[model samples]
Target: MKSALKISGYCLIRKNRVVLDGRVLFETGPMDFSSFAAEAYLHFNTCYPKFHKMDNLSKLGFLASDILIRDKKITESFKGREIAIMLMNSSSSLDTDKTYQQTITDRNNYFPSPAVFVYTLPNVVIGEICIRHKIYGEGNFFITEKFDAILLDHIVNHLFNDGLALCCIAGWTEVNGENYESALFLIEESSGTGSGIANFGPAETESIYQGI
Candidate 1:
């Protein structure tokens, strides 16, 4: 048996509220995705100016990541290359795609700005997190019809078994229009730490994502 895997920490974001380790850290009334995201940015004191420039999808993912990875200082415990990130979503940046399309639908009003153009891809959120935390390990983003906790379980295990990663951040993040949901978990081996919050496996992971 390759030592136990543990779910050290996790964060969930939904309906303009952010939850960390089962506690609601921030919650707000009805608001647009941009307004909620900006409010979250300020509330958390992220201090990253680039956050304001990111599209809705990136902002959502970045916020969840910052709460789990940066705020918790998970990356500080492992080497950059020893950490990995795996994220899955349903919309796959469609929210930003729609916005991009709006800027070019009119022949005369079409505008191509790199600022908005760069966030067209879903993995950009992964890029932003990696850049912020200096995580150089393997990172992969997948698009599924819905959250597939089993698939994520297998991938995370494979990375650890093959020595591709010592610690990992994996979960589901999806943003469509004003709706968004994310549940990111920080997984680590059980040698040094006491069992963590719980073991990292399909059942545990799926349960958390399901409940979230």
Candidate 2:
């Protein structure tokens, strides 16, 4: 059994910037979320074409997870059932829901779009990440009023303690239209089999996120 849960890597997407493990990799100077996401996607050279069609929420989580999965190369060390993803946010897909509501709100123009309808749930972001990375371990999306580091810490530990997961992609992802912020961390064992994998918990996670 692993002795401790460690944070392998972290990525924060906020203020039109992308910070991966304390380094600024990409920044869209003074642009809106839509434009910033497009530029960041292209800048990172991510080949996921479906990225163009994702709602703002999915886009935020995708690009942030992309840094850890593609940039930090976590998938190279952990894959399939060994990797899990757990995330929480306050908005709970309300941003996309508002847009979907518009499709059916007006009597004359009540035309619902299946494409827009698909992203009405907050879990869509997790599904997008899981499908893209092929991670089959426990994936959960929680709705919280604020950043609950204690809650995130407990859930992640439970996955590891119960031997249900080896590595977990965890954090907070909240998106409300043009206003969005996400902090994702890759959690692993502190003194386990991996090298250069830094050491875990709510305080550490909170500090890493707060610094960004």
Candidate 3:
């Protein structure tokens, strides 16, 4: 069996605050979801124009992954298809679903935007991340009552053990109205350089997330 995986990096976003590797990168007062995400993008100096066009769900995933892999040193070492992404959330795009519902609620002014309609599925966030990073690896999005660290750990390990991916981005991202939270971790083989958390499993993941 392969050695236990390690957490190379992680980012957490919640309550108008952003934390990376246990350090606060940005914080703000009450703001809408769009403004909150936009502030984070700007704080990181991210220049991706597509960010503005994405729904709240995609934007949350994109920002969390972008921050976690900003340096690119870790991800660049592997092929595009060698990196996977797994994400879960409780809301499952309900935030966008509500917005989309508003457009069609009035029959006389019914106008459902194709742009908004496309993001109804939660997995679209994964596609956005893949598009930005050019990752062609396996990816999936799940909806659960709450974060399930054990399932995430098992699936991530399965991908690595099966040679489906050399590394993975796994975590939870949920956005509902003005409330949003995300915790993303980059999992890969242990390099034994002491550059990351040496032990990565359900317990460790849950601990890190709770602490965040």
**Which pairs, if any, clash in model 2?**
none
**lDDT at 67 for candidate 1?**
86
Off by more than 4 A, model 3: 192-194
Tell me the tens digit of each residue's lDDT in model 2 across 81-173.
Answer: 898899999989999999999999999998999999999999999999988988888989999998899999889989989989888899999
- Candidate 2: residue 13 lDDT (0-100): 93
Question: Which residue pairs in candidate 1 have backbone atoms (N, alpha carbon, C) closer than 3 angstroms, thus clashing?
Answer: none
TM-score of each: 0.95, 0.95, 0.95
Write down the TM-score for model 3.
0.95
Q: Give the TM-score of candidate 2.
A: 0.95
Model 1 agreement with the true structure over 1-212: per-residue lDDT tens digits: 46579998899999878988888899999998888989999999999998888888888889998988865677667888998999999989898888888888899987876787788899999999899889999999999999897898889989999999999999998999777899999998878555677799888888887763
The local distance difference test score of each candidate is: 0.87, 0.88, 0.88
**Model 1, residue 110: what's the lDDT?**
72
lDDT of 3 by residue, 1-212 (tens): 86578998888988888888888989999988788889889999989999999999899889999988775455568788888999999989899999889989999999998889999999999999988888999999889888899999889989988989888999999988887889999898886345686377888899989983
Better of 1 and 2 by lDDT: 2
Worst 10 residues of 1 by lDDT: 189-198
Model 3's lDDT to the true fold?
0.88
